[model samples]
Target: MLKKLGVLAATGMIMTALTGCGSSNNDLTTNKDTAKPGSEKAASGDTGLLNGAGSTFVNPLFSKMFSEYSKEHADVKVNYQSIGSGGGIKQLTAKTVDFAASDAPMKDDELKAAGGNVLHIPVTLGGVAIAYNLEGVKNLKLTPENIADIYNGKIKKWNDPKIAADNKGVALPATDIFPVHRSDGSGTTHIVTTYLNAAVPAKWTKEQTGKSVKWANVGTGAKGNEGVAGQVQNTPGSIGYVELAYVIQNNMTAASIKNKDGQFVAPTLETVTSAAKGALTTIPEDLKVKLSNQPGKDSYPIVGTTWVLVPENLTLDKAKAEKMLTMLKWAVTDGQKYAGELNYAPMPKELQDKGVEALKKVKVNGEAVLK
Candidate 1:
């Protein structure tokens, strides 16, 4: 039985702080492509900063990129608000943020109504680690079946023999089990449910569930990644899942997960990137390729891509709009170098090609950013 997280619980969240890797405080205040003798520099005649909202999952990484990007180009500033994916999309549709951050992509009609194209740039890759706290338990490994059992409330204690069976020689505990989950419409929840649905279809389903599931299991509910981290840290015998970034930042012990490739891999930059290896040249003209449970030996599976939501129209302030496009271009290309150090995967070369192609659709004065 998979845990349905839609319900609430009373507890705390445990988070681990892993120093972000390859992060740079490099900023580009002004967009200037020094032209060759006769080459033209790309500019929209607008020079200012841009502000964006949505996607708490990528907030840490984006913040690093923005801060680094700000150093050189004080003229332009990029600010991202971690308001969660659902809110991000709503903000994007409402024209609130210059760009939206979402783990998930927009739907077809949603794209149409906006009268522009949506590009899915998977700038980073990571997995949701099931963090837990227990007595005398330093390292706990878990398979998909065990995760399913715990969330389903089928296994109720830290010392379940079934789990002991899998980890074989590790000492088990007797603490009461507490499960933590998100309470908002999160892309993180969507990635986990997508994994459960794939690994154990009979118990899971074919639904496009969000970060917080209709968790049938009983536990506490937190607001965002930070909220869940707070909940788990305060509670004993508590287990909750969040992106690898949070797990590292909070200093929590994460469980080993079985991936679609049939190998049980721990959440790491290496594993996460391996799982994202085979994405299509163009993410389905519709963005429905579930990256969880992908099949491969090195593939850790259970991965998710963070997407940038840009509006097709230049209906907003011109200076702000150009700055938004500037950040997107840099983040997807140069800034990606920092992904691994942050425990995230960089976009694959081919996939980046697809991304660059999709970004071609982003326009200002009928000119493509890639151009």
Candidate 2:
């Protein structure tokens, strides 16, 4: 399959893209000739630049969304860094970037440290797939116990009875199992840990749920989602959890995790959509909520929602703020059409309306930033 549009190579290249510009909005310039009537560029003569960093898990989707957005509104440019979620939050707190994207919601300490009040803008919903690179494996079924034991070092071999029992009649290998995990602070890690904690309380309880966790001695660590996916693809008998987009991009074998209904469900657009529908109903005023291990018969077990961090008050030039707001509004509305094509679950219309309401609250000197 063709690599999804705008999915760039990860690691150092991510930072290079951000710093190469000298500043986030520096290169943006008014394109008077290309401006459209009633368009954001027509209204605001300011250079249309929006800078964001964080969540390698969402990088591919954002890359597609932003690229398609530029096609429609030629004046605006968005530069996003695929650094780990921790780096994104740090840059946002320091006021060095226009916004930040995080898979995990900010902790209380992080919220207190922000130079300006931050708002959580929920973006697309997705799932974390437990994918493996076994030479002859096909359709692996992992129960809650099987997953817990594999990560906590209780199960060392691919042919372990617990895993075999879940997939009867399948040939099982006696090779040692290598568990791969994220080395960086990441929302993907948080979602996996959160699911583990809820699905297998006894083992995952000892390890707190966060972007970074203490892996059992048996597991190895890799940097970003791309790093983990690369390690799993190259190393046989290795299993790692990553967003569904990576699974699709790499064509790796994903495991079916046992859900709350006791059915082993694979991560697909339909299952993840079911999970999001059940979880998005009660989104709090803050818009920070986890969608993993949701209750539903067909729901995938390890789903999560990603958020874009924006300031409640616009401290940047009003033109820049308006431009940023315009592009963001487009992402949740018109930009949603590209989501399903990329294997991401678009927010439901009702929840999207609420998200738009939150975006409308952004203001400059106590007035709405975008008219």
Candidate 3:
């Protein structure tokens, strides 16, 4: 049965340190403004404040990108809330934020509820690391079946036969396996569930894919990527799925998941980028696509793309709209250089071009802002 763990007292310290790395107040501007081709000039006396929420999956990159953008434009300030993707979409629909970010593209019904003018502009690519807390185990290998069963509560011990089969030589403990998941709505949840659903359909049904799912009565729930990372960090024999950056930042142990090509791939910039190759060619015109379980020898199995959601026809004042679009355009273009350092993959040139084109559709009061 599922058992909930209390939020650990040390979790706050871990999150504080993790988020501190990308604090907006820190001026570490090292890049030039190369967005001149479609840049917008901030009007005099404009507050130039742009507020956004969503996608803790993209938080590190967003923290750096927004900070750098503000450095280049003194008048423009960006405040992004690293809430889960679901909360961000809700804020966007409620008109409480200027933009929203999510790893999972909004569903058609969600799009329709927001006046049907929203555009999904992909900003970064990353892997959902299957992080675990097991002593004396440095390298762990997992298959889709092993994962499906673990979360399904069918595999209750760390040394379960299914898990042991993948790591033949490793001495796995017989400790009870604890699975941690997002307690709130999250796009990270979407990416992991989507991968599980596709990789092992019979075990992880389509009904389980989305921003949130009724996980089997096993494991506990944590609030954000940091929360999950912390849960895994503090609990021995626990396993959780989190964005790759958090795994890196926390120095947590991650598993090498076997891909469709039968190769065990670790999450890296190259592997995550490789995961997008198949999807890039078949991506929809809306730019809404999934990159999990792609057919490539080098592709990481749990990768996903994060997008910034902006209304095609903005309701903000002309100045605010112009500045907001300008910053966003920069994010998808010049801002990409900062992604790799934070454990995220820069968008491929093809996807970057499409993102720019989508941003061009944004208008303020029927007048195009990018032109």
Q: What is the lDDT of residue 270 in candidate 1?
A: 71
Worst 10 residues of 1 by lDDT: 29-38
Candidate 2 runs further than 4 Å off? 1-46
Over 285-354, each residue of candidate 2 has an lDDT whose tens digit, in order, gives: 8888778888898999898888888988867788788888889888878778777766789988877777
Best by TM-score: 3
lDDT-based ranking: 3, 2, 1
Which 10-residue window in model 3 sums to the lowest lDDT? 29-38
The deviation in Å at residue 341 for candidate 2 is 0.8
Shift of residue 269 alpha carbon in model 1, Å: 1.2
Error of 3 at 152 (Å): 1.0
A best-first ranking of the candidates according to their TM-score comes to 3, 2, 1
lDDT by residue (18-97, candidate 3, tens digit) is 33112222222111112121122222334486777788888767777777777789888776777789888987898877
Q: Candidate 1 residues 297-358, lDDT tens each?
A: 77766788788877665665545555667677778888787666556777766666666566
The global C-alpha lDDT for each of the candidates, from Candidate 1 onward, is 0.65, 0.77, 0.81
Model 3 stretches astray by more than 4 angstroms: 1-46
